[model samples]
Target chain A: MCTMIAERASIQGSGKTENAWISIDSCDIYYDHPDHVDSEHAITLSFSNQLDPINSRISLEITPESAKEIIRKIKAALSKGDSLER
Target chain B: MKNYKTHDYEGLIAETIQFNSANGDSINAYFAKPLHKGKFPCVVLIHHLPGWDELYKEFTRKFAHHGYIAICPDLYFREGNGSPDDVAAEVRSKGGVSDEQVIEDISGAVDYISKLDISDGKIGLFGTCSGGRHAFLLGCSTDKFDAIVECWGGNVIMDESSTNEKQPVSPSSLTANFSGSLLGIFGNEDTSPNPKQVNEHERLLKAENKDFVFHRYDGAGHGFNYYDRPIYRQEQSVDSWVKIFDFLDNKLRS
Candidate 1:
């Protein structure tokens, strides 16, 4: 598609990066061209705090299959408390 | 190297320039012109949604090398400066630039070009993707240009459910207000301004008795002229570029 197929979904998680612990306030996920990934289209997700543009950014670009795998792994990790990785 | 023909000395000066729009908003733009002195036709090149990046600057230089003055305003200038991709991402997350503000900025650009000592009093307009839609919008909204070329413009037909909040009306709706000659290039595979939409556009223009030309290339999709993207169609882009230049020369020069 020419325009982004995007959605504003809420994410619950916090991660530390660049010597700062940034809480993700907003998340925008879309299926579109990935800047860093050399793919025509991919699942792009950005976890950010709208107020702090600099501190809160965890961008991920993954293939559809990879995204599904990540979802599966995440579910297993949360349920089992310890999940096996391939 | 490809033996490209040049009508003048292929020297140019390109740099970032600041210009105040009619709204008193100072914006940054990539300004380029031929180093050689005579008055030259001006081009107000609107950058695509992909942020005003290196490719656009290259286009500016290309025009300058071809003996024309060109300026591509950074539409994201109002937002704090950031990398092109980051700026684009931020703008998209914020729902993009407003159509009214964009129109005002474009008005300023046209005014700026008209006052330049090196200007030949002729201004050519060009844009692709979202910028392409803006070119068509400006064409109908004002008589500030001599020629306009819109390449694969999306959202001009306005899918209401998918329309961005910033753009309240479809450019197609204002077809009756269009002035000067317009040259539109599209891809048969594009869905935004698909073949059906293009047909309707032509029909409306004909009904209004406006002077415009439209062409659709097979085996090409949206952003086909974008050399760096996966959608690039080399043959069609080359053909389209030729058409754009010819249109400018025909309308602005003779």
Candidate 2:
């Protein structure tokens, strides 16, 4: 089923494709069927350059637990880095 | 009810052809027909949100083998080229195909098949998931189809608050206009059109005095017919296929 559950964010970042690094202008996070994942549903983090085609993007599909863990790790790293700087 | 013969000649021709759909967009379609010299009913297949994949081609041929001319149009032709999954992912990001465009494309297919030399002018619709929703939509929007088979179509009873440019209205709202006999195949475990929603759909049809039948499987969930997926249920899938053919035979081959 197409959950149609999605969220979009406009951000600036650089991501690697097959052969080159491209400037990504947008990111889309959606929970739906995965293209390659074995699970019926996965939370996907997709980064894309609007100039390129829609499919020409770097994407990740992981379980809900994995997504939460990534979020935790990112916050932990940021907090520790900030403390060190201070 | 079998679409085969024990001791007779059997063959079919399947190929890809392009035709103008909505707004004169030339879209590709896979068409299959029996080689025998006889008029046959046409089944315009509506591929699911998975884009135009190999499974649908297999379905087109399966119908042809059973003496029906089948055609599955590429609903995502305007979205550019890529693998089926890639294209489907892109379509999903874009909020799915618009209901109006799909209806026009399907209407065009019906028109195209009606002109075929072997056409019996009896057209039916078959679709799964989102495609199933579109099938029911078209069946109600116009009197073009003689039969409709909708398999696990989600969002048929859309929330009014969620209506958008793509899907402006719920299909259930248009049940009063339905002209064809319908066969609904659903799984009770499905989330989108859960058992309660299915009951609502059935109730709406009954109130309108529409010609429709529904079958629900207890253990099966969404996409149970998708053999490649983990949710596939062999017992339910086989039984549903038999039901589909029997329903089509009664409605279209009359």
Candidate 3:
């Protein structure tokens, strides 16, 4: 199925569009049909500078399991950093 | 109507053209048609969530070679045509195009195809995946089309669990509003528009005395007809393609 279930958030960063560099305004992550990925459904993420509209964006398409694993790893890393700081 | 039952498979002209869609928004479209002299029925092809790409162009030409005027309007035209993946991601983030916008876009397609010298003014629509849902939606939303081929459209049977406004209304509830016949091709294993949903939709259509044909293959799953996808089931896809032709011929040519 084409799942448009996505979460969007404002972010501070910079990404290249087509040619020039621009400040990224937001990030979106969702699970939907994959374009080049072999899987029927993949979790995809896109970072874009909405102001640019035509440039400065990046995207990734990965499997749901992989997405879950990445989330777990990110949480683990954050917890490890907190423990180290304490 | 000119008989294309046994026409030699000569080539047809295929090209990209820009036209205005809903709200007077100019969008890119792929148009294909046979070179034979006489008016021909039209098949308005709708692209899936993958966004308009080369595969749909291939489908358009395939229809043209088989003797129909086919045009696939890039639904992503509003987002600005770029790489399919990029446009798809943007669209996904934006919660996808609205149902009303889609209906109007199809109307734009009808407008474009209706004026062509080769067009017979009869048009049937075929859409895969999300496009399939749009196809079914248009059948209930508009009267410009004579037939609709919905291939494994997910979420056509959704309720108020309403993922988003993009699919605010369940097409199944509007079964009686269909202006013409519908042909649905599905895979038994597909969970989106699962077998039960297909049966339920059929039940509604039948109760309404609507013209409908549904084919559910056992071994296939969602997107079984997509040649470029991993789930492509050659046998089932071939059969469904033949069914598409038959449905179009019956609805538009008959």
Candidate 4:
């Protein structure tokens, strides 16, 4: 005897004028952000679906001022130039 | 060459030495010497891109401890306490300090060091980063330097674009002009003079048959000798210091 099962799952959320969605299958996972997503925000995702669907999606909203701070730190690290690996 | 333990002589009669450059600009420098001093060998220490700071003062103290009269000149005196970004922006916008000005300022320091009663008229030049570039420039501009040590100076083979003043400060061109042996220490990972540029510099010196020693350390990035910075490498710094002292002893002291 042989049996087959099919499952469908979807995630949706909105915070500080931003929204995102995640979809998963046994073979592939997909994530999408709405066109209205703010430029000041960053998106991060983590998942534990090794064979098929990736797990979770995360969205972080960051202001322009914070972006500048992030740039400064990156510049400092990059100042070591091509010689340093970080 | 004897190694003396480092000592701090902060707030010890650090006098400002000012003079008119050949371009009719006033140059400011700091002169530090032992309170009890006979004639001493003088050293002209040049500041890096950050200009004269506490590190320079500490260097003066180190030189003074070894019975050497030390002078550290503010290469960018016109703009005080300005950030490196400011200097870089100015250079990109209106061009920075001229090579003529650098030569004049350094020559003036050499003259001042030579004229000092505590000096034997035998002087050496030491610089880091941009100041290191100036040390090479000063050495090429004048033979007054008995010895020269440059740390992580960029592009010894000068180009019109490399120098703001459109002056050629290449080591290959200046090799024959140099009357004293030179020491150049750089980090292998330094992006300024990537491996290719360093190899070219070595080739130039070899072709010119110049008397020079070059050392490039692995795993060290640009400005690795700077203790306050995260890139500081203790092993390379200590080893380079020892080599510098040896070079100075053989070429300047003896």
Measured against the native two-chain assembly using Cα atoms, what DockQ does each of the candidate structures obtain, in the order listed?
0.32, 0.47, 0.49, 0.02
Best by TM-score: 2
Global Cα lDDT for candidate 2: 0.88
Residue A8 error, candidate 3, Å: 1.7
- lDDT tens digits by residue: candidate 3, B1-254: 22345565576899999877867877889999998888999999989987888888999998898789999998987786567767877777777888888887888888999899888889899999889999998999888889899999888888878745666788878888888889999999887888888889889889999888999998998888778877888999888888888888889887
Q: Which stretches of candidate 1 lie over 4 Å from their true place?
A: A14-23, A33-41, A54-56, A63-86, B1-8, B159-165
Lowest-sum lDDT 10-residue window in model 4 chain B: B85-94
User: What residue runs in model 3 are displaced by over 4 Å at the alpha carbon?
Assistant: A14-23, B1-9, B163-165
Best by DockQ: 3
Pairs clashing within candidate 1: none
lDDT of 1: 0.82
lDDT of 1 by residue, B132-221 (tens): 999999998998888999987877887577555688898889999999889999999887677988898889999999999998999987
Clash tally for model 4: 2
lDDT of 2 at A9: 88
* lDDT of every predicted structure (CA atoms): 0.82, 0.88, 0.84, 0.63
| Cα shift from native, residue A36, model 4 (Å) | 36
Backbone clash numbers for all candidates listed: 0, 0, 2, 2
| Model 3 / residue A66 / CA error / Å | 1.5
Is 2 or 3 the stronger prediction by DockQ?
3
